[model samples]
Target: MNALFKALSHPVRRSIIDMLRKGPMASGDIAAAFDMSWPTITGHLNALKEAGLVSPERDGASIRYRLEISAVEEALAFLLQMTGAGRKDPGDEP
Candidate 1:
């Protein structure tokens, strides 16, 4: 969970996930959206991967990344906890 929060803490990473919500994208396409170099974007992708926030599948020579929505849900669950709702789980909403 710590890894997930850390991965999402960055604006670029959040933006990447937001863009991916539209659909899966090639790493190059995602990298192109930022002014940073490809390697920097890749580092963000790696962090997201470590948190299970994103998963990449190989298609021929290109790698397409898909967002794991459940990770976002987990983050929301954490927020709910921080809000002092006293709910142990996100699904326990009254």
Candidate 2:
């Protein structure tokens, strides 16, 4: 999807997704891993959320973000299709 690609276009956002792969983490914890300000990291998180790549849930006073694996799978499948990978050619023999 357009939104997914747009969100993934930024290195910061990509890194955020990588971090989330481990497990859900508090926003503060995620911000601490980077050198940028908390507000800046928040912007990247917002993009990921808008693209459906991440979901934020309230955890008491803090919010934890979790990766949406289905969205990642959707992107992977699209890439595979575009590259003719994991897809059979119609002319191939059975």
Candidate 3:
């Protein structure tokens, strides 16, 4: 999907998703892993959320982010389709 590709276009966002894949993480914790400002990290997270690649929740004073693996799978499926993996069976050919 366009959104998934857009979200993954940045290396930072990919790394952020990798971090979250282990489990949900607080916004601060995710930001701390990088040498960037909190607001900058927040923006990246927002992009990921917009792409449906991640989900966020408010916990106390921090927002926790989690990876949406299904979105990643959808992207992968799109890629596979491009490679002809999604074609119908030979018996079903027109």
Candidate 4:
């Protein structure tokens, strides 16, 4: 999941993911939310797509990006496993 982590390393990509959490959004709409140029926003979207965090759907002439929750879950599962979550410890006081 190096690609997933790498894509998430950027603040812009994180913001894009956050925006997509609401629902699928057009590329133009996503780009409008950022101060950077369209090309820069596109690069971030490409990273997210490469990481499987987002999927692009063709909506007529525009492309809408939707979040892939399963991929996100995969990442969360990894983090939870590394953190030892949901594991009962018998060495604790009752």
TM-score for each model: 0.86, 0.94, 0.88, 0.92
Compute the lDDT for candidate 3: 0.93
Of the candidates numbered 1 and 4, which has the greater TM-score value? Answer: 4
Give lDDT tens digits, candidate 3, residues 31-61. 8899998789989999999999999999998
Ranking by TM-score: 2, 4, 3, 1
Clashing pairs in 1: none
Model 1 residue 6 CA deviation in Å: 0.6
Q: Report clash pairs, candidate 3.
A: none
| True lDDT of residue 58, candidate 1 | 96
Span of ten consecutive residues with least summed lDDT in model 3: 85-94
Candidate 3 TM-score to native: 0.88
Compared with the true structure, all predictions reach lDDT values of 0.92, 0.96, 0.93, 0.96
Q: Candidate 1 lDDT, tens digit per residue, 11-87?
A: 99999999999999999899989999888999999999999999999978999999999988888888988996655
Superposed model 3: Cα runs more than 4 Å off: 86-94
Best by TM-score: 2
Instruction: Compare the candidates by lDDT and give the number of the best one.
Output: 4
In model 1, the runs with Cα more than 4 Å from the true position are: 85-94
Instruction: Compose the digit string of candidate 4's lDDT tens values, residues 48-91.
Output: 99999999999999999999999999999999989999666999
lDDT of 1 at 36: 99
- Residue-level lDDT of model 2, residues 23-90, one tens digit each, is 99999999999999888999999999999999999999999999999999999999999998998889
